[model samples]
Target: MADFNYAFISLVLLLPLALLIFLYLIVRPRSVNIPLKNRHVFITGGSSGIGLALAHQAASEGARVSILARSLKKLEEAKDAVRLSTGIDVAVFAADVRDYDAISKAVDEAGPIDVLVVNQGVFVPQELAEQDMDEVKFMLDVNLLGAFHMIKAALPTMKNRVDRRPASIALMSSQAGQVGVYGYTAYSASKFGLRGLAEALQQEVIGDNIHISLIFPPDTDTPGLVEEEKRRPELTNIIAAGGGRMKAELVAKKALNGIKSGSFIIPCNFEGALLSVATAGLSPQRSFLMAFLEVVTAGIIRIVGLCFQWVWYDSIQKWHAQKKRT
Candidate 1:
């Protein structure tokens, strides 16, 4: 009797599975592994910190690297350091990312780019009320509009590469980009703009066989972070307390790995992973299994995210109360 209904039962069960498989095949990003070897990898903010570390890694991996920054002296220093470490001479360009003309000239001279990393950013942590308007404008210009200028300048050449191999554009976003935190009003606004930019850019470039990666790195041990710590407000520190700091080399490695894999969202730590899953709204995902995880765990992650928000709010209230007493 059961055997008689086997075909009907199988059809019912397998149809849903088949539909899911079809969706996975179509919706998933065109999977790609962008090869860095013997390819041009152009990095903005390459003079120091995570950008320099990434430049070093790409060079060591046999990539033809070009480093760009506003300061020519720092660019020269980065070139020397990369040469000393990898024995590969990387091209250096001095161009402020804010200036589209300067960026366009640099991209034209660097030749066709196989991978473009927009890693330049600036942050001045202060409550929105107390922060100067100029500081907000500076962060918005450098962190948000600066990336726009670089992408606009580089995209035409990157799309027309003779080799026609897959290319990558990696945006260096912070955890603040994923979620707004205390005293990061202006900074978070600028960084959060990157997520929207990355998501839309992916849709525009997928036809050109280009992939976009948005990297969310927690506080990393870098010269910039050292400087940022001196001005961090007490509330900012409290809000950022638990997320651990990672070394620049590790962050660079993570960023490169994600870039090569055509990953859409690259998270650098445990908290970052949790944050990614929680904020996985409508972002392009190349990995089928990761997409499944994101879909299945959405409800659970929402609960956990709420719990985290509650804790954060509790901290804020307690800190404010303690401050008022003093």
Candidate 2:
């Protein structure tokens, strides 16, 4: 009996070890380190919030940074802030991401970009029944289509860059992108669209040594979040309350680090990391260890995800019951 127990324990230990070794050998698009130093890092929506923070972090890392936004004044302000903090002057461009012609002109003038950060996004949280069509269109245009416009404009130059080093295109997606949330109908759709774009774009750009990173930051303490909170539905706020907020600078630091490491899914906080693993799907993973963890934890993570759904639905049911009582 003792000998049988020992053999069963050995098998349990050996199974995981074998699995880890197998995963390390088969992971595709193998790990790469994309150097940021002396590279041109171009960011959109860099006038404020996470975009401005990314500009600062990139400049500090010795990259030639350029910021673009609709307001030239805010862009100038962001440039000055980076200069003050890092003593590095960043180029500023004024253009709306929704305008392909203007954004394309800006990209052409900025020259070949080694790193393109598509950080522009806008969100208005409301249930589909209550949300206006115009508001829905606005979110889709700026958050989803804007990303398309920026990438379409920069792809040619990025593909032909003289540096010939590994380039990066990082998209700023929200936790809402991973799972649908109450009252985030239009907003979530826009963010979710980014995942599809990143997945397909990676396949197209891999030959050019261009890597794609989809950054998933939970509720960040940015101006945009502040504005979003004011308009967020009660149920939306309740559903999102479980996820903690992160500072813009902290999120930017995490994002930049993930970009440098060629991480396809960059999660800012602990909760964001959990969301990434739970929604790994068929996304490219460079880290074999992470891939192993995803495989091992898939079943338990699904249960945890279901538990979260239960909690969220419970909150919704309670809120409706209270409304009926009132």
Candidate 3:
């Protein structure tokens, strides 16, 4: 009986060990390190907030940085800020991401980009019933289509970059992209669209040594978030409060580190990391250890995800009940 029990315990341990070995072998694309130093890192929406912070981080890391935005004044200010902080002068381009022609022109002028950070985004928080169609379209245009415009413009040059090193395209997606949130229907849709873009684009660009990173940052303390909070629905605020928020600088640092490491899914916080694993799906994973963790934790994470949903729905129901009482 004791021998049988020992064998059972051994089998249990071996099962996971075997699974880990299997996952390590099957993980595709393999591990890679995309260095940022001496590379040209181009960022959009770099006039302020996370974009500006990314510009500063990239420049400080020894990369030649370039910032683009609609306002030349803000772009100049961002450039000066980077220079003051890092003593590295970053190129500034004035253009709107929604305008393909303008973005294409800016990309051409910026030359071959080693790292293209599609950081431009706009959000208006309102329920689908109350949201303006124009605002919905605006979010889709700037957050989703704008990414298409920037990527389409930069791909050719990025593919032909003289450096021939591993290039990166990092998309700034929100935690809302991972899961639908109340009063963020349009905004979430736009951010969700980025995941599809990143997944498919990775397949297309892998041959060119271009890696894709989808950065998922929870509510970040940025100017955009400040504005968004002012207009956020009470229910939306209540539901979103659980994810917490990170400073723009901290988020940027996390994003840049993820880009440099060629990580496919860059989660800025512990919650974001759990979301990434829960939503791993068929996304390419380079790190075998992460793959193992994803596989092992899948069931538990799903239960946790369901628990979160329960709480969110409970909050919604109570909120409505309170409204009825009032």
Candidate 4:
């Protein structure tokens, strides 16, 4: 009985990954006929993290890739890294996601793109009461406004491409956008907006052969992750209790496959994917509130455990070691 139960759960879990992979395999030649080969793939915030990882993936898949970010040095490094990994030459452009003109310039420089991935974002943790105006504004500008500028400039060419294969757009969002979390008011809002944009764009472009995918990745292990942990306040212990962080490679693979599959909401994490599919079927009002409450509640519980461990466990462990020596 136990074995049967285990198998059932395993199927429940692996079923989704298999299904997504199958979707990608099924759509590879039928929908796009190109498999991203010799295609111009443009990625925002591609200097590092998942964006860079996706650049590497696209390179390996035979795509001529270009990445845009704000740091020239980091962009060079990322280009080198992708070159090392995939033996492909990738172009790096320094452009701020928030600037439409700058993004337009970068796009022109890269030329027509076959696949555009908007993966740039910012996470500002602030409470509504404290209203860290600077952080909140920066988050809105980078996470929301930046996405808008990139999409607006890329849509024209994406829709009217003269290439053999139709173009596709992938927007990188997060589980936080799928649900609300404490101290992530602005971040959540920006992601939710991206979610909305992808949905509307997908609908409006019906029969145009232009695909749009909204990706919701959970907290992933990346360079930005270390910074988040270092800056994390004691209160953030609450959110730290879930599964270990996701990897950039895993999330990037999912994003690429999701785009191929024309998935409406691509969850970057397994748990996130399950929840996304489940909630996407429900009313938006109920789904958002429920998801929000779950994030907040889990965060609080984890933080409480962290506070207790800090208060009592460290000293106890040290004392136990001394007693053992004595």
User: Cα miss at 288, model 4 (Å)?
Assistant: 23
Global CA lDDT computed for model 1: 0.91
On lDDT, the stronger of 1 and 4 is: 1
Clashing pairs in 4: 238-299, 238-303
lDDT tens digits by residue: candidate 4, 81-138: 9888778889989989878899998888788888889898877565668767888889
Per-model TM against the reference: 0.93, 0.98, 0.98, 0.75
Model 1 regions lying over 4 Å from their true place: 1-23
Give one digit per residue, the lDDT tens place, for model 1 in 1-326.
Answer: 78869988999888767756865786667668989999999999999999999999999999999999999999999999999998999999999998999999999999989999999988899999999999999999999999999999999988888888899999999999988999999999999999999988898998899999999999998888899999999878877765667999999999999999989999998989989999999998878767767877899999998998899999889988999999
How many residue pairs clash in model 1? 0
Kindly report which residue stretches of model 3 are placed more than 4 angstroms away from their true locations once superposed: none
Candidate 2 lDDT over 1-326, as tens digits, reads 99999999999999999998998999888899999999999999998999999999999999999999999989888888889999999999999999999999999999999999999999889889988999999999999999999999999989998878899999999999999989889888999999999999999999999999999888888889899898899998887877678899999999999999999999999998898999999999989999999999999999999999999999999999999999
Point out the higher-scoring one by lDDT: 2 or 3: 2
Q: 185-215, model 3: which lDDT tens digit per residue? A: 9889999999999999999999999999999
Candidate 2: pairs in clash: none
Give me candidate 1's TM-score against the actual structure.
0.93
Report lDDT (Cα) of residue 182, candidate 1.
92
- Superposed on all Cα atoms, the candidates' RMSDs to the truth, in angstroms, are 3.0, 1.0, 0.9, 9.7
Which is the leading candidate under lDDT?
2
Candidate models: Cα lDDT each: 0.91, 0.93, 0.92, 0.74
Clash count of each predicted structure: 0, 0, 0, 2
In lDDT terms, how accurate is model 2? 0.93
